[model samples]
Target: MDIDVFATAHRLEWQRLDALIRRRRRLTGPEVDELVELYQRAATHLSTVRSSGQDPALTARLSGLVARGRSAVTGAHASAWGDVSGFFVRTFPAVLYRMRWWWIGSALLSLALGAGIAVWIMADPQVQAAIGPPEEIRAYVEHDFANYYVEHPGASFAAQVWTNNAWVSALALVLGVFGCLPTVYVLAQNAANLGVAGGLMFAHGKGDIFLGLIIPHGLLELTAVFVAAGVGIKLGWTLIAPGPRPRLQALAEEARAAMAVVLGLVVVLFVSGLIEGFVTGWVHITWLRIAIGVAAEALFLAYVFVLGRKAVHEGETGDIAHRPETAPVAG
Candidate 1:
């Protein structure tokens, strides 16, 4: 018998026997043990026949057994949405909670970049000269800043900011599958631009003014970007180090993890957009901006940390509750 034929036949017989046991709908411990023994014997016989390069009949029998086993295994009904709730509660929260460091690090990095650009623009005489007179800068700045709010007084500036955040986040998540290169490049460019803009504003003695305008919506917006970028990096690295699993299998697993991160980000983007569109546009008071910004930041932090922890706990409890229990055997 050919080795492949023998192996296939051996599997088929085991399957058929398994199906028979299930169909009988009643089995004692000894009966189950007997079935197991028969399966082992069949497998052993198939192996021996293959090694001897004989017994085509044995190979055929084994093939039939394998088919039966497959049928038995797949015969049971399964729930369609059994996995989704657990995924959201356990997997999503775990990913977000664990990634807090990435969010904080990215925010600090963005702030540093912004500060560096502010200093550079302030110190550079040539750049300052190129930027032209103070009147030109003031006129351009006033027009750019005032035009939108002036035209649409009822429009939510906070919401627009949040929308921009969602666009950046979606880009990060979708492009992350390609590896971290795209995400890293995008982050770098954003950081550089922020820095340049900050520097220009500070050089013109508008440092406090700029912060007042940006800080209202920036805290959550910036954190979301970093979290999204971190997720992309993680996905890219999974492809690079698949460990014992096949490359494709590893990639699939990483994609699952990335999806959880992205889902949480959608929530973040929605809230951030609301703040940007509504709060930032209508609220010109510094104290009000600070109050609202702090409250928003606190809410996000609580969601990521406290709510995520609770989700993990709930997942563990659910798993224990849902697991099938086996009956005790008679002596």
Candidate 2:
């Protein structure tokens, strides 16, 4: 396995195969046969060069040649639409369903914290004063709270909400590997903010208005955030308890599923943003707005429970099993 000798011996065959691949469309029957032969031989060469720890440059060259040869042999893969279809039908929903308890628990816990904070703030004048000046609080409860939603144009507001929520969710996922503390901090901060706002509104006797405005969009929006935090926390937990699988394998599986959740939440959050921007401020009908929110939340839950369950039953783990780029060094 002399590195220089191997490279010199197979260099011509590699070049010939490259040329044939570039012009594969116009190759005669014999040339196509020769191309296939050369490709097979080069694949073996690649394996040998790699195993022997020979010249890295020669290995890279062979790797590229084999990849191109695979494309030529296998033709193109399935269309983009196929991938998208599989994602929604299997990957996204399966992930949501599989991790339902984690996210649901997260939502319940966060809601409790937020509600506790609100009650504490309402019960204690000192808490209210600690938050801000009385005049500012009065202004917020009387005017600012309701006006915040309507201050911007609906479309612009929706876009802003989408961007902000997506960033928060993405950040949670990205930082998940650091352990669960950061994820818990994110969840706590979100809950505390909600608590403060609700406490202020309730204390001022604008509780009904708060419910009318926040419930319409908050149901779905908060659920999406909870899913992100739950999945993130689960990622951190995977480090502590990888279960039966090896730690790296367990982490990889969770990571793949987390990615699917991230993509799925983008769509979920977008819908919630639309409700917040368009329906919450401008609709002005209490029952109707709340009904719309309930409907959206129900649909999302159904999607996860029904479709996701089915996909999981069919053995979809939300990870793409086949990856072409993962050749020998792939996966």
Candidate 3:
């Protein structure tokens, strides 16, 4: 005479009866009354089961049956973006609030390490000696700046550079799933090269020339790099600290958030590629280049640091946060 079992069984029967009624089927008033009574009984039983610390298998089974019956009556449909917006609204503020330190710290460390390594390589005479004679280094530098594109005469230089930039950006994002180690390595390697090139430009008294060439696009390109690196770090950290969830579940949640960051970075890289291929080489005026570079940097920083932070905060507690949760349930 376990009332819990009786109530659970009745709930299951009531759900089946509700589904039958929804399918344009006829049900007498007494049938509807019976269904309501059963539902109430099940609710009461659930409270008792919860208090007793017993497995609620019967309750879960009833719920599943009810869900299946409803699906049968209404038909399956895909969930809309509007339906899931509440999840993003609730989650982003917490994540952004926690992630600010990681983003800033990683950017500073990467920049400082990259610059330090570059300086060391350029200043050490033995290092230069190991790289071979001055003539060889000069030849390499000239090839990199001027002659590399000449070797591939058929392909459109602009197209090639754009394609290569896109591929590299994508690789950075995809490789981040593997604990972000690969992405970090890629970013570090690129930073090292940039540092060396910058050092060489200064040593040869062509620092101004280098600045004019790189400033226009490098502003966007470098920001893209930092964003990608930050995403990878976020993913890796989730695995390290999963809160109350199991590690695998935590990793999956992190991947979803990291994907959003990657999507944002892709847009950045596309703009950077366009600037690099078309504007950087054509715009030779130092003053114009500086203006464009500074403007672009200001805009990017405003969006990434200021606007992004505000959006996350508003999303968590504003009207936008409730819209998704209140969306019509998919039939």
- Please report the candidate that would top TM-score against the real structure: 2
Q: What is the C-alpha lDDT profile of model 3 across 1-331, one tens digit per residue? A: 4756766566555565556546434656775565555555544654555455444554454444444444444554336875445334344333444456765665687789778876776688677666557887776565566344244432365567656766766666567667768878877877787887777665666667667777887877776676666667766767777789777766766676665555555566667766666667666677886688778878877654564566665643212221111112223
TM-scores for every predicted model: 0.64, 0.81, 0.65
Rank all candidate structures by their TM-score, best first, as comma-separated numbers: 2, 3, 1
Task: Give the alpha carbon lDDT tens digit for every residue of 1-331 in model 1.
Answer: 4666755766655665756656645756766666666656665764576466455554555545533433333454335576566565566666777656655665676668767766877899677667677677776455554344435544555455556777887776566667667877777777877776667777767777667767777777777888887777666766877789767666766676667777767777777777666776568787798688788888877866786777755543112232112212222
lDDT for each candidate structure? 0.65, 0.88, 0.61
Per-residue alpha-carbon lDDT of candidate 2 for residues 233-311, written as tens digits (9 for 90 to 100): 8899998789998787788779988989988898999999999999999998899999999999999889899999999
Report the lDDT of model 3 for residue 261: 56
TM-score of 3: 0.65
lDDT of 3 at 91: 42
Candidate 2 has a TM-score of 0.81
Give candidate 3's root-mean-square deviation (CA, Å): 7.7
**Which ten contiguous residues of candidate 2 have the minimum total lDDT?**
322-331
